[model samples]
Target: MQYRTNPDYWNQWYPSDLISESFPGQFRNWFYSLLVMATVLDNSPPFKANFTYGTLVAEDGRAMHKSWGNSIEFNKAADKMGVDVMRWMYCNHKSENNLFFGYNRADEVRRQFLLPLWNAYKFLVNYAILDDWTPNGETLPILDNVLDTWIISRLNQVIDKVNTLIQNYDPFNATLVVESFINDLTNWYIRRSRRRFWRSEQDNDKKHAYAVLYHVITTLTRLLAPITPFVTEVMYQNLVHSNNPPQHIPFEGEGQGVMSHESVHHCEYPKADLSLVNDDILDQMSVARQVCSLGLSARNQAGLKVRQPLSKILVHMGDYHTELKPEFVQIILDELNVKQFEIVSKVESLVAYQVLPNNKILGPKFGRQFPKIRQALVVADHAEIVKKVNNGESISLDIDGESVVIYPDEVVIQTKPIEGLAVGADKHMTVGIDTIITDELATEGMSRELVRHIQALRKEAGFNIEDRITVYYQTDGDIANVFDTWTDYIKEETLTNELVSGTHAEEIFTKSVKIGKHEVMFGLKKI
Candidate 1:
């Protein structure tokens, strides 16, 4: 393989240092930079040094080779998950490290993240259309509601994080922040606001909710434009700017159109106005979230579901009382399906439990010490440990006659149960549960499960959101009684006009239908 032996052929083809870059190398550099720039433009601040650039060679210094079957072909990946999903994978991956591509990893991304996001987006579109939601030309007004302001602040925060990460070549963090936002939108924002979208026209709050969500969806579509081009474009066309004519946004350079044709790519990244992001507001919200998580986790552990309504939840706010007070109290009550959140100062009322490390502030310093430090800290008094840690005191330990100084950086302090409360805390957060589960709560849980099943049936039956329907019950006993109790819920959920008690009814061919347990049938007709 010596080039010196074949002087004529080798010399003509390969010139040292003067040879043009290989197609693969050129493509990689271009693609990598494009993604990096897109991310930078999404957030306002630049990423740190650790976030920038990655090396291509393996630790052994070998270039990845295709003949060795170690290289990934983009076209093959595109064929499998569609181009947008592939693009998302690339945008989300850690840019500071060489990415090892494989079929399995790609499949995992599609299944665990991409598909869920797509499904959520589809759900939003389906419901929005059904509700005949359209954003009135009014701009959003500043509001005192935490939900409203929190979402806007979060949107701006995402823009900042994404831009900084992208600009600094930290695609991993960028991707993570965006993914978090998507989860928030689907699970919290949309789920909590579903009733507003479905309410009657006379409800002004419904209109305001629609407007807020509309702004959010539209802004999200634009924000995601660079990462998942095709999907975002499709979403934008279907959801936002639907009345306008189609227009293409080019990837690079200066371009203009009759309208402001500044591609979302070229648009300035959004800046976070500090006035919008209130730490106190966020802390209160965290309390609400903690309470909700505890209740939900408790429900899951007890084999109870979210639809069940508890009579009350006692929140043991040892140190967090003032923080969790009136602000998020109502939100916690709604999220936990509890009638009230009784704030308790003592742990004596708690019944069931779980404990977790408070690792957020402590993990960075004490991660190296691990099990030994954790053990010692667990037995120590909470107030004493807190005082020492806050005062910057260091504890000395004798390990094999060698003095080891356990500074604040060498140990972690966490909360532990001494008495009554049913509690749980994880690395970053904590929660507590109520022990009692009532019969009415169980029935409500069953009702919720039924609603989920009916919704699934409707989707499977190809019923559109605007479809009006009637449900027929053919069963007796508990299930029948459950349906009877929640007839109005079923009607609202299925967009049904009626729910008949009878088993048999004349069917219309044009109508969509689904049959469930014990020959219960759901019939749908487009209004």
Candidate 2:
């Protein structure tokens, strides 16, 4: 179909920039035919690039079969797993791998990725409405606040990456990068920024925090619009204030809502705000996040819940070069709920290396003598074995008078925490927790626990987030003593006007809850 011969019909869509379809079958069918027709007509291909996607299979790597009860009807899957979940699962996966789509996988996608994103949105919207914070302008705000700077920098970086990935049709990695940003946004940024939002004064810092998050989320909606049309449309409409937004959206007041745009699809794909990018903050935050991760791991290793405060953390930056500033160190300490932290060069005082056989990979290969091989590995020099495994060397072992070789992949180098101090290590760094909890530390942990209960009570009492309530407690012994000792701390956290000693009004909400080993009755009354 030459456009020169029949201009009216042929010029409508003569050459597409790209074509995408399922692999081999498309190559044999429509793809082959389209190229043939285009070549015969004008000596060219119809599209500049061709993308082929892989097939879907059951989770067990078998074809979908009704007889085997391994198949899912489209409507059933869509209705149960949700269209957004299915789309996320598809987008998050590499196009060349067989996608094992099922309820289980979809549930994981919802829990692992979508849940955090949704929580962040919910947190922002709830707090925004509580404080009556609305997007004032479209420009990204530059702030001197460490968290504000770091998150904005991250937002710009993702904008650039997602734009590039989308242009190249690399949706898998693009979604992955977005998910990582979401994790940082919810877990790190928003968690750290909560106090800024909760402060009594409506300060410039608070406004900038909301603005940065608003920009990040709305821009993300625009970027995700193509892939998740329904959710993104809903999110954009609900999140952004628009005068003419649909009735169902979360729009309350009208100013510059939606910037006169009706839908997210109408908005321009977000461009990276290069002016906001700070490589230094990004690098520092990266190390900070990884350090927090290892610190949490150490806490888990020590059977210590985050609610139980630890004394300190000892971090060894094995190869990482970023120097933790005071603020960055403060973030790690606050996040991990540790008192102090020290940077050390050697982690031997915190962790011990041991070589363990990967039973799964070696089990089938050395079936009968696997136990003997394991025994040999157990008696081997731990440090030397770790060195060999790390360097990709194989170890020779004697089992029943026969020499057996253990390859690097057949073993795992494990870092065990020291007996009293729990430690977690990875390639980049090692973090060890001070497992010794002093009386003061335990009391502080108790205070944090009380804060949790007070927040829950506020919610249970149908009180608004900004509502200040006087707290009443009736307890004896340590529970009562903790309340008296940390009265100001509790009041500061729960927005209490007063910490009363007795019960509340007969009509107000009161609940007796367990703290540690004893029960304490708590009452709340709105003022």
Local distance difference test scores for all models: 0.59, 0.82
Please provide, for model 1 over 1-527, each residue's C-alpha lDDT reduced to its tens digit, 9 standing for 90 to 100.
24558768854543222222233454467445644764664532222222233444422345668676566566876787688766766666655456545566667777766776677667666665676655434345444566776676677678767778767656677788988887777777777766666665636676566556655665666667777777766666665444333443211111112222334444433444556566666667666776688768756765555566766676665446455657577777778777766765544344322222446644665567545545555554544444455567866544446565666654444444334224554432344555465777766666676677667766767766566766554456666787888888777776767766654446632222232343344444334
Clashes of 2: 2
Q: Would you estimate the TM-scores of all the predictions? A: 0.67, 0.81
**Which pairs, if any, clash in model 2?**
241-257, 242-257
**Could you tell me which 10 consecutive residues in candidate 1 have the lowest summed lDDT?**
249-258
Question: Model 2 over residues 1-527: C-alpha lDDT tens digits?
Answer: 55778776776676887888998568789998998988998787798878788889988889899999999999999899888888988899999878897888988999988788778878888888888877644355557789998987887788889989988988999999998899889878998998998887898888888877876677778777887787777777677635233432212111123343688888767777687788888899889989999888878877898988888889988768889889999998889988898988776767787777899988899898888889999898876676566567888887879888989899987777777798877755778999998888888888899999999999999998789898888888887888999998899999999999897556778999999898989888899
Query: Top lDDT: which candidate number?
Result: 2
- Best-performing candidate as measured by TM-score: 2
